[model samples]
Target: MSGKTISELTNEELLDKRKKAKNANIISAVLIGFFVGIAVFSAIKKGLGFFTFFPLIFVFMLMRNQSEAKELDKEIKSRNLHF
Candidate 1:
């Protein structure tokens, strides 16, 4: 995260950041689903072992991106901002 506070950002900057954060979250979710699907297929073809870890990693990443999106949402809300 940057040291700059959300208050320091202009409205356009804030909206852009929010849009990027939302896009990142959406991408992360899609990746998570893709990884999970692969993990399931791997489990079905080959026994579970290291292959299972990939989906877990994706899940963690998804959670992180979701948190980031939530933080952006909070900032937008605090400023009563709209895009």
Candidate 2:
């Protein structure tokens, strides 16, 4: 990540940052799926516990990442740039 904000980044930097964000979002999604699977399995075997609730945090992060991606898309569009 750069010190500059999204609005301040040059087109190249913006594109790079968007790529990183997409990768991060993909990773987050994978983790969320994994955590949800663990939560479900844990719940079935041990009843409600820490594992069951752990996925919530990842879900929140995933949502935030998605929002960030949307913001990046908006910025790109505002600049009349295509991806």
Candidate 3:
């Protein structure tokens, strides 16, 4: 199929896609952990919240990435501005 890859998207779209992907990835990871925790506990394991860490880490990374992307986009647009 002919579709824009991450690199092919515009800066704003790229940032938005990254944010969405990060969030979804984090959520999926957390869910996997939850299910894993359940399975482990069901088989002589202990309780832990380790999986919750994914969301926190993702939020921080996503924020930073988004900010950087915005800055880069601004810089590019400024340079390309016609006066």
Residue 24 of model 3 has an lDDT of: 64
Which segments of model 3 are wrong by more than 4 Å?
Answer: 45-83
Better of 2 and 3 by lDDT: 2
lDDT of 1 by residue, 1-83 (tens): 27777778777888998888878877877888898888888888897978866787868867865776677778889889885
Ranking by TM-score: 2, 1, 3
Which runs in model 1 stand beyond 4 Å of their true positions?
1-3
For model 2, how big is the CA root-mean-square deviation?
1.8
Candidate order, lDDT descending: 2, 1, 3
Q: 1 or 2, which is superior by TM-score?
A: 2
lDDT of 1 at 27: 80
Q: In candidate 2, residue 69 scores what lDDT?
A: 85
Clashes of each: 0, 0, 0
Number of the top candidate by TM-score?
2
Candidate 2 structure quality by residue, lDDT tens digits, 1-83: 46777899889888887889889988887888888888889999999989788887777777765887888899999999877
Candidate 2: where is the Cα deviation over 4 Å?
none
Give me candidate 3's TM-score against the actual structure: 0.46
Which one wins by TM-score: 1 or 3? 1
Question: Which 10 residues in a row give candidate 3 its minimum summed lDDT?
Answer: 74-83
| Residue 77 of model 2, lDDT score | 93
TM-score of every prediction relative to native: 0.80, 0.82, 0.46
Model 2 residue 53 lDDT score: 88
